[model samples]
Target: MVNFTHQDQGTSASCWQQAGLEQIAALDPEKLFHAMASVIVLAAHPDDETLGAGGLIRMALGQGTDVHVIVCSFGEASHPDSTTHSAAQLAALRHAELAEAMDMLRAQGPRSGTLHLHCLGLDDGKLAAQQEPIRAALEQHAGERCLIASTYRGDGHPDHEILGLLAADCALAHNACHLEFPIWFWHWAQPDRQPSFRHWFRLALDASSTDAKARALEAHRSQTTPLSALPGDEVLLSEGFLQHFSRGAEIFRATWPGHRDAASAPAVFDELYGEREDPWEYRSSRYERRKQQILLACLPQERYAAVLELGCSIGVQSAELARRSTRLLAVDASATALAQARRAVAGMDHVELLQATVPRQFPQLEPGSLQLVVLSEMGYFLAADELEQVLAASAAALQAGGELVVCHWLHPIEGWPLDGEEVHRMAGQLGWERIVEHREADFLLEILRKPAGAHG
Candidate 1:
């Protein structure tokens, strides 16, 4: 269990005692809620990740949990009114600062390994255009299981909110366990007032955890102005991160679906992948061939008792799989594709349609539910590391003797993980034996089997 001690900082401790506020307790070590895998922190900018859950991260890493970070935006719009630096320069500076901060966070002593950092180069506040890149990254890192941390919707900043929503989308798309931390939510947790009484759950920070958190926050020297540079007496003493431990009096609700005032999905190819006679021509045609490859990789075989396809695009392969599988779970990231899949598979009761993404909308398949898992052409468009999440969830849901199929174009794409070969090779290392390896001149196909008696 986490241990805590109130700091004898004179007035600070006294004020809290007088106001009837107690020190938050450290996280319970025995809680089943504790995840035993790597922790992935998704942030819109540099400091947000550390500020929101630095203490928790420090504790997790110190406890030997591998830490992976994915910063979606590049912080180009930060402090936009500053006259001393250009937008590009500010972005570069912030990036450098984050690099230093990451080094510091990793410097914490772990029993075995160090933290891993992945900084995706997406536009600071423009996430819509970068969806493909983000998805690609997530697909690359889809693991057996993951503990993800990100901001909440009420975190005050628009970019933060968008990141939170996107992170949730990625979580659903990948079907991983997730936890959200809300930074800059101080406005919601003010003293018990009238109708605005904010709801919050508190966790006390132990001495060691608190010290680590302070050190991590201090790593961001670029953000602290000269006046805010004092050590323990710094002006930003509260750590600037809050979390919703309990729902409390807060009313949790989701916005209605299909109420979009704007087109959220992008225009992409809608056709059977890898079926074109001129395979090379299609493969070389920018994203056209890659799209086919992703779909094909995600849907390997027509034979299975139960199959779940997440982010099924345009019913391209869904229509084909509908003919082969006894029952299929066809999911889509785009409403456009879902609508199309609905029409394409309308007469078929074998396929259950769902509009959801990973880590968040994991299809609640029963244990030993699936015979095969396919990633197809969808893995490259996510944030790379998140792909581990999808893979982990798939592993849990897959039965013994099941096969995992992956197919992706070998063509080079900028700002994504290594090509299809690299992806398969990594997958091979994750306890699955590669049973079938198909290498076409244009794409790579791999069928990996879950070793017998592996799912105990």
Candidate 2:
């Protein structure tokens, strides 16, 4: 069962006080102090700002730092208490709810303050309709030096995904920093399938901040009850945000754009998503089977000095990797999944479990010491350019002629920056020489060798 910080002692408005216990482990003092400067929260709706970054905003305000909120919509059509209400009425109530939420967030104890709130007045669900204006708002406010926080595409919310894309564009246009926080869409996006390392910001809310967060979330009483009702929902003891730094020029990925054909990517989900006792059973069932097949096909039947597998969800693949490598580092973002992985691979002496995200450069890892880097079912989560950085970082992590593997699920995701095929094409652009390419009925796997003479 998923563990969450439960807040039964207080009203629903104060539930957020318990939201961060899991997230606090990810934060350190250095990261918290870094976030004290300018902070920006880009929300698809008013409640989102509170849901995702309320603790961080409160921290910024407490430190007398600048904090800005950009709300894409007034959430005119969202109201959990009024099923019989019309859209117009719902909009009115949501707007009022947002005003109250903002007050609770910025105001002391029970009063609202004059914190800056920017609203685009876009249609709540039809965020794509207001893309132009949304883009402009993000670009205008995302000046250099500001730390911006937005939603991740995996949240399974359309508006939130668009906001993520818009935030990426703003980061590119103004060269600012940006992060993605998971929110309500966690209802549908499976826990094991979500991106682990993409969130760059790691923040912890203290006990007092937790109290303020609960009160701030409680202020949106109409929204919280329903959100908390979603499957596996739990109030957190602490809350935080995640960030993925940009690699180069911002790469915009849209199915609507005629970028490149993603026809060649693998569709792993279609083959494995059957009714199972554990929703994440595929990690052990079909996922493990396929990963074994890919490892056997790509890796030599010999031992290696070192190997790194980023986003190694359940160590299904990492176990097989352990047999072929001397030392293996497996990292994921979910502590629960990592715990399960630790148990699954407990007997393997050469494996290490870590909590981290992809598109992240593990500079501390022994550079030029690793022989192989495997990224499976993890590439599609990032924007196009970010994938390139992951490849570069993998190259840096490896010695000359080191091996790098690329694998991603091919089925169409609603708002991914690029499909699996586009990610592979970008990998080809890197200096690595292609070694083996496997095309099966379900997935695509490619192995590339770093040049011995040229630096990766």
Candidate 3:
């Protein structure tokens, strides 16, 4: 069973408060604080840094770690109805407020000149449009190894979600630890509805750090206090809302290092398919062409009654698998990739292509139904635990003497969570009798089978 902080909490507190507190108790602050030499905080707007992770910034600086903040937007549109300030004036005011907040946070630490701030100055409410520039800015400033804290992707704001994704990407690219701080998610999202993969943890703030956070939040008067008397021009951050951040601990969540499930996988293929149908040269690469031929030739049976191919990107291999199977289920996480696959296999009625994420979205097959299961060049996409789930599900679906073929690249991918060798080793430990093992300079192909007399 999946262990969630919210599920184990036995408290009379509201669901939100219990969930927040549960996450807060999960991590040891003393260890997490000293593990990093540098910290980078990515904020969608001026006040987000302070509201979401001001205490964390204070704690990091006090521990003598260098802290850098990158603000993605000036938040001019946050108060669009302000009678006292125009958008330009509002942007300038938020900029000044951010500097003041940084100053307050810096004052809590012993080191001078340790806190640095960079304002991307992108248009407010349009950071999504400037993803490339924002990503470039993050890449330029990111240190070799640092702790990156950004807004949670599920923070219910477009700018916050986009910046969070870019920050995660930059962190993964640089091999840094990435943390997500929620601003609006705490206010609106139900605890049970949060993504399962997020490893929730909390950073406890001492009195001094808490005081510094309060001062930092006070710096953003434009948000906390009302600017105009007009009924429509409301205070963006109310006292009740600010109370959530003023607690003794701040809530945070981290993504799986190097490997992400469907929820957190970088939108690489989804965006790549938008530009061109074949991004990785799936259809025309000599290397891929040979691998596909070898894969088909090594299948144990001449024809499979039922076959399932996981991560069948663009259905290049799916087209071939369709010819060998009475019915084939080809599934991939990217709908864009599946759309192209549909076109490639337009005339194949036996091949069914679906956009589904695995382990979670895996189709339920009756016991002893499927004769062949193919996991090609896709095992590295799952983490260790998810791979086990896939292995168990596949084992349960396979018929007597069924073949499970796994082919993966031997080389390690920089940001992928699992390597091909690790995936193959786990498959070997599943009590299946090894049938064929093919080793190449660049890849490894292994075929395993259930004993013919084994019960389903």
Tell me, by lDDT, which candidate is best.
3
Q: What would the per-residue lDDT of candidate 1 be over residues 1-456, giving only the tens digit for each residue? A: 012211212123233234443333223532412545666777877777776766556666767777777887767665554556567876787788787777666544427335777788788767755777766666566455565667764455666666666655555544454455654443333322111111223445556656655566676655553222344323222322222211111111111111110112222222222243332344246656555554554544546788877666656567777776898888766555567668778899888888765644567778788887767765654433345546666777889888787877788754343467666665675678777677777777777888777742
Provide the lowest-lDDT 10-residue window in model 3: 1-10
TM-score of each: 0.44, 0.47, 0.64
The Cα error of candidate 3 at residue 454, in Å, is 32
Task: List pairs with backbone clashes in candidate 3.
Answer: 258-417, 259-417
| Candidate-wise lDDT, in order | 0.57, 0.60, 0.78
Per-residue C-alpha lDDT of model 2 across residues 283-323, encoded as one tens digit per residue: 55776476567656677537788988876766777787888
What is model 1's C-alpha RMSD?
17.6
**Better model by TM-score: candidate 1 vs candidate 2:** 2
Runs in model 1 lying further than 4 Å from the true structure: 1-34, 107-110, 173-175, 188-201, 226-456
* Order of quality (TM-score): 3, 2, 1
What TM-score does structure 2 among the candidates reach? 0.47
Residue 352, candidate 2: Cα error in Å is 40
Deviation (Å) of 253 in candidate 1: 13
Ranking of models by lDDT: 3, 2, 1
Clashes of each: 51, 24, 2
Question: Model 3 Cα displacement at 318 (Å)?
Answer: 6.2
